[model samples]
Target: MPLVEINFDGLVGPSHNYAGLSLGNLASASHGGDPSYPRAAALQGLGKMRHNLNLGLAQGFFAPLPRPNGAFLDALGLSGVEPAGEAERRLRAAAWSASAMWTANAATVSPAPDTADGRCHLTAANLVTMPHRSQEWPDTVRQLRLAFADTAHFAVHDAVPACFGDEGAANHMRMAAHHAAPGLEIFVYGRHTKDTGGGAFPARQHEQASRAVARLHGLNPAQALFVEQSAEAIAAGAFHNDVVAVANERVLFTHELAFADPEGTYAAIRAAQPEAEIVVVPASAVSLADAIASYLFNGQVLTLPGGAMGLVIPLEAWEHPRVRAYLDGLLASNGPIRKVLPVDVRQSMANGGGPACLRLRVVADPAAIDPRFLLDEARIALLESVVAAHWPEQIDPTDIGSAALARSVQAARAAVLEAAGLTELA
Candidate 1:
């Protein structure tokens, strides 16, 4: 087989909690101060991975980043002491965030066929729009380097400058006849460098940042299309483009209000890949509110082993009346997407992520990547055992600063690293 798309999920960390640091993420804001179950969250994520693996898809994983980031807290002048104020406490919470588990925000990847060089390229996302996510790229780049260390097959770049915020694959999409083919790369941005739009919420992806990533990855100018995400979508809590839109192979599954100009966007996509199958769910059938709430569009639309496309959605989308009706109609219509497999990811959903958010898609041969980062039956069992033994059963927001929790979180992560033989990341 030629290069194949591998879904690399981020293993949910022991520090998983709900501090609600993300400004525009409605689920995070709504679930603030709510108790979180880290063990359940990690297990849910692992189960999703197992589901895909069983479907005969290529699966890989990135380990959780170091948390209770002492260096970050120290830089903020709050190290080695208890937080004395609400502002200081917020900083501590940010430091302890397990937000890195959402690997979709980890990097922007351009496969070998699309890039100038014959090697696949990945650039870590700067994530400068939110303070909590801003601290992610450095550690993200470290892991990217280790995983894609095969210089002949991959080239990993650090993030573009922080002046323009980049949210990685969350605001990007690729369309091709097949995973191995050179494809049209779409970089979606929420704001222009000079414009201050996005209404109540900040536009996280900058047009300039998207362009920078395209350049860094050495994508062909004509093959790269830069589109602006609609302000309405952003205000509706589609914090990233993936919230309202997702593309796999030649199909674009999106909400009606996903883009600023849906028709033009579709036209451009069809122009680039004439075989592109666009399945748009009208707002009447499933409103943007319902789409975002249920994360209907946040599911992974993947080509199954049997050649039919399957949508890996969250259980929330399955239970949603409008979303479910639309999906049923889609399946009945004999459309490109045939299967709607919903898995439980309630823990991640409550924290503002879904199946798509939990993964970073990389198109490459499994042999070209580090085997340790890849998943198998044995690896899955090992990971499940580690999470069951070490991950915190539940984490209250107030537990962010507890010394015992911090020790447990750190020790848990260390154990996972040791078990995986990836202690170098520790």
Candidate 2:
């Protein structure tokens, strides 16, 4: 039962739109009220999954959660009724948000090797920072339970209490000799209090929440590190740690301003894992603004089959002169990252998510996972065909409450469930 890392990406939902629901996400705010192409978004996501699969990696996917969530509307006392005002209409729009497609925020995972009971532990993220995301955990937990049903090898827990907001793996990083080995898990929190420096936005990941998650996972206190995300980074729109840094095996790719104390962070990591290779993109070469704009650190730094590290970034990063220059130098220097694979996720990038935000990384024995959730060429074709035939080509913010659009969105998701033989989720 050899363990390997499996990337479980969330299938971009048919209701994917730019409602501008996320507060700290600059891109989402900027793109609010714009027309969205759901069909193109879903297809682009599938293309990314196919890209990773072609790289000889084990890939899995989570079906989109039911949207225009009637239950959520009911909770808000807006079910089956027309909105009374602009505020109510905004509430209704929140119900249709497809932000759940960013599965990196779906859960916080501690691989078997890092936990006390020798089982992979996953806790659904509370995501209490925003109204739309707060509705995600319960549905996310239901999906997790189904996919990791083998209790012998996996433990899926409900989200930590909403009192302390937790944003999941987007704020977490793990470094080890290899995926299956015992790893040093680092949790990056925004602040200890609600009144903190993110300028105009809130610091989503609370320090208390990060500690609570570590405790729930039964991680050895010595092996766990809790660090604060730089206030400057947060104010500059590095809303999540993944926005500034990413880790894979022995390598950590990050920006110079990613943490409150870069040298201290590096020293701690080296002390915990002596082989840690810290690759910092100096601020002089790529400023915080450029890094955030390009989402340069929001890429998937993974180990290729040949045992060399490769980074999967978005086309936006490749196109940025500074980011491109930095990447070119990274490869020419014969550093830990040997390759930079650029992907087209403009649909997601436009809404403040990039390549890393689209997936969740889990380390486990593949045999323990539900096979239907795993992807193959046939399953990829099934998904592509379904999206092509059913997903909406475009959705305008003005069309959010239209009955015809709602029906189409609902039917499209149902079609995907049926095509993937996952009606049990429905």
Candidate 3:
């Protein structure tokens, strides 16, 4: 009955490029229109997966959602015919979107222990705030259904209605004594669709969306807690909850401005799990600007095999002086996070994602899940080889409309599908 938390990382899609699609994301806007190295990005992501696998953690992979989505274009009232105009250009942009690479937004997962059916449930995100990202849910739902298809162990639900924006696990967190234990489910919302309380940034995760997802999963209301994300964090570019906080097992590491009322939220979580540890980084020690810039809180505190914990962070944190000193102090002390490993996800980092943003945590009995989604040394090697040979080295924003680029991306995805024995997905 033991269940381990499995990290399902999104394979950086072959169309990975900077389109400056995210408005509130500082890095996304700052590095907009810059050329992106899709091959390098995918390889770095694969390397991270390999590192976790070596650490004796269960690792899973979600293939990039299909791009050049024609269905999306039709809905936008754009045709596929030639003699294309501005409308066609905009449509092609959505089709070539690689934002699907951030799988943390893929779905909100309710582990077997938290669900009424005693089965894990997943709801694909309806990323309605961003036009490019809004096109992802249908394809993401398809991918989720395929990856977690075992009905005996899993339930895959369609996204909530598009009227209410839902950003999935990026806005959800669960804290339990063990992966399989019934625990606290924290749903963080920024604004309601009708209420524009998000200050400077558009609040993507609606309270209604979170409530609907919890209802769909049949989560016990007593165990579920809904919280509003701080407008300060949102205005400061903490676009998602994972951007300001991350949780694993019994620990929740977050910044001071993560919630509207940090103290009250922490107390509720404590009431649920009296033994829960909440690590808050004071605003004076690290300003919200620096925290978002370095993505300090985005680091994952993974429980190693011997019960010790390690902090998996992006190289950006090591480069930030204040953040680096804080991390050093934590490791130097007798804290639960004993190890600090800096990974090179510079490509994703440049586009406003960090180590935490690349993954979706699914706590389940590995034996009960689909085997093809799991990865090992051999599969990692195969994925790396396929990416190097097929993924485009660089994709400029201008290249998003290129038919050749779109074809190359689809072909690269097909190669990965073939390697994973998921030709049906291809």
Candidate 4:
């Protein structure tokens, strides 16, 4: 059986709001307290899925976990306690966070071909870098178990210990000759505690955590390349590796400064995969500022049905003069990326997520995945209608603590789950 990369996108939860929770994320801080349009956000995501489906790419959906998470509050010793002070305010803010909508941080996946067990392995991310997001793993694991439950085809493991922060696929990249073949898995981390190449931004993924994941999947150390993320990139708001670099099959599209040592990193990747295609976008052509602002590298690079590659980017990229010109040049030339498709995901963009952030890439047979999580035209119609009818048009920061808002979010999620015949997950 032939294997292919399937994009499993997280349904933007109704709790989607801008509370400015993530310290390193530029968009989250810039748009803090802004009114969020949940209905529009979700529909935009579903539209992207539909577009991919029409393009004959395999697309999947990961259900949003119920929010206003009481468990998280209870762990912090705040649940069941009435709000009377700043601590309560902070706790409440964390409770209403829609951070889970960026499912790229959900888990680190080792496709069946890469793992020793021959079963695709996924370990939920601990996400300990941010307070609100730290609470996602438990629910994310539950959803993962349901979506990829076949023991013969999938192995869903618990998150790594909390002491070691793990941000999942956001910091991981893979490349192979083909989806089913053995490949190189690159885990990018920040500066080590002992090595003092510094930055103010937090390093979300720990090297120890990455090693733990590799061992859990029984991956050979030679095939697993652990590279340090450039402190410069982190300072520039490339908080995750996906922000600076992205890979599909044998090609690596990245900014020159994506790694601590560009020369060494490129050599290592090439050494691992002899036929690797590395496309480095120099800062001279498009400043790192423009790349970060436009999320140019966050675009999804897919091997289209016709054997050509397409870069599915956000509208922001097309609007940026420098980045747009660069993309146009690449297309005009005989580059690996043959086309550029711009998508509208302004709602997620406003909150610091782009096309890549919305999806988790899993290399597997579509038939091996649970049928309920896969999407079709009819399923998309049902999801779109549910979002249109039940999702809130706007959710303000002040609305985070509203009991009515919580109930509404739950109702909307339940409706979508029912529509997808995934009520068991609900």
User: How close is every model to the real structure, measured as TM-score?
Assistant: 0.98, 0.98, 0.96, 0.97
The local distance difference test score of each candidate is 0.93, 0.94, 0.88, 0.89
* Cα RMSD of predicted structure 1: 1.2
Can you write out model 4's per-residue Cα lDDT over 343-422, one digit (the tens) per residue? 99999998999999999999888788888888889988888999999999999877877889989999998998888888
Q: After superposition, how far is residue 230 of candidate 2 from its true place, in Å?
A: 0.2
User: Cα deviation of 337 in candidate 3 (Å)?
Assistant: 1.7
- Please give the range of 10 consecutive residues that has the lowest summed lDDT in model 3: 191-200
lDDT of 1 by residue, 1-426 (tens): 579999999999999999988999999999999999999999999999999999999999999999989889889987877888877878889999999999999999999999988899999999998888899999999999999999999999999989988999999999999999999999999864246442778889989989998998899898999998888899889999999999999999988899888899999999889999999999999998999999998999999987899999999999999888988899999989989999999999999999999999999988989889999989999999999999999998778889999999999999999999998899
Question: In terms of TM-score, which candidate is stronger, 2 or 4?
Answer: 2
Off by over 4 Å in 4: 80-87, 192-197
Which predicted model would earn the best lDDT? 2
Candidate 2 positional error at 199, Å: 1.3
Query: Which pairs clash in model 3?
Result: 68-95
Of the two candidates 1 and 4, the one with more favorable lDDT, higher being better, is 1
* lDDT comparing candidate 1 with the true structure: 0.93
Question: Candidate 3 lDDT, tens digit per residue, 1-426?
Answer: 588899999999998888777879999989888999999999999999999999999999998877777677677665455426754665567667778888899999999899999999999999999888998888788878887788998999999999999999999999989777898999999964246443667889999999999999999999999999988898899999998998888999899899999999999999999979888888888899999999987777899998988889999998899998888887887776789888999999999999988999998888877788999999999999999999999998778767798789889989988988888776
Error of 1 at 340 (Å): 0.3
RMSD list, candidates in order: 1.2, 1.1, 1.9, 1.4
Candidate 3 TM-score over all chains jointly: 0.96
